[model samples]
Target: MNFLIRLLVTALAAMVTAYILPGVNIKDFTSALILALVLAILNLLVKPILVLLTLPATILTLGLFLLVINAVIILLAARLVKGFSVDGFFWALIFSVVLTVVSSIMHSIAGGNND
Candidate 1:
């Protein structure tokens, strides 16, 4: 299914992030899979509400605040998923950014939706 493919891509992205970002540590493939699942769920279930709540700030910041929101979401996912560690807020921010970029590139190359 497409959902499973997306999850796999996300897990791959997490692994790539762990390799590239020093502060993001994924203990194993299992941890990467878990982190990817949590991130996908958070993006689906929580991100819209957050975007709505932060609409004013998002507008003020010209959409830059979404990066902060994404970092916070990644931090939350790190907390929820075992064996996946994000060193600190700054690390989480960097991890989130790298993951986003890598995932986007992979998705596009794979001819998948960015959802």
Candidate 2:
């Protein structure tokens, strides 16, 4: 199904991004898959709430505060998922940014939905 394909792409991207970032570590492809799922769930359930709560700061920073929120999500994912670790907040920030880029590229290559 479409969801499965997208999940695979995300897992691939996570593995690739982890390989590129020394401060990030993923145990294996399975861990990457779990990481992707955890991230999706967090984004779906938690990110919106965080965004709403931080709306003022987000507006003040011209949306830059979203990056901090992304890092927080990544750190939370790290704690929730076994076999994945982010060295610190700085690494979490870097990991989230790089993972976004990698996942976007992979999704595009996989003919992902524009939405």
Candidate 3:
């Protein structure tokens, strides 16, 4: 199904991010998949509430604040998922950005929505 495909896409992206960034460590493909699933679930369940709560800052920063929100969410996922770890907030931020970029590129090549 579409959800499974997206999960796999995210897992691939997570793997690529871990490969490219020294501060990110994913034990294996299965760990990447688990991290991806947790991230997706957190983004789905918590991101909206965060966005709504931070609407003022988001508007003030011209939407750039969403990047910080995303980084925080990634850190949350790293904490929740075993065998996946981000060294620090800086690494978490970098990992999230890398994941987004990789996933976007992969989805573009696959003809699917990156989100």
TM-score of each: 0.92, 0.97, 0.94
Identify the runs in model 1 with alpha carbons over 4 angstroms from their true place: 113-115
lDDT of 3: 0.90
TM value for model 3: 0.94
- For residues 1-115, could you state the per-residue lDDT of candidate 1 as single tens digits? 8888888888999999899988889999998988888998999999999999999999999999999999899889988999998889899888888888998888888899645
List per-prediction Cα lDDT, in the order shown.
0.90, 0.94, 0.90
Best by TM-score: 2
Better of 2 and 3 by TM-score: 2
Model 2 misplacement above 4 A: none
Q: Can you write out model 2's per-residue Cα lDDT over 20-110, one digit (the tens) per residue?
A: 9999999999999999999999999999999999999999999999999999999999999999999999999999999899988888888
Q: Which sequence of candidate numbers ranks them by TM-score, best first? A: 2, 3, 1
**Per-residue error (Å), model 1, residue 94:** 1.2
Q: What C-alpha root-mean-square deviation, in Å, does candidate 1 show against the real structure?
A: 1.6
Q: What would the per-residue lDDT of candidate 3 be over residues 1-115, giving only the tens digit for each residue?
A: 7788888988998998899999999999999899888988899999999999999999999999999999899889888989999899999888888888999898788788535
CA error at residue 68 for candidate 3, angstroms: 0.6
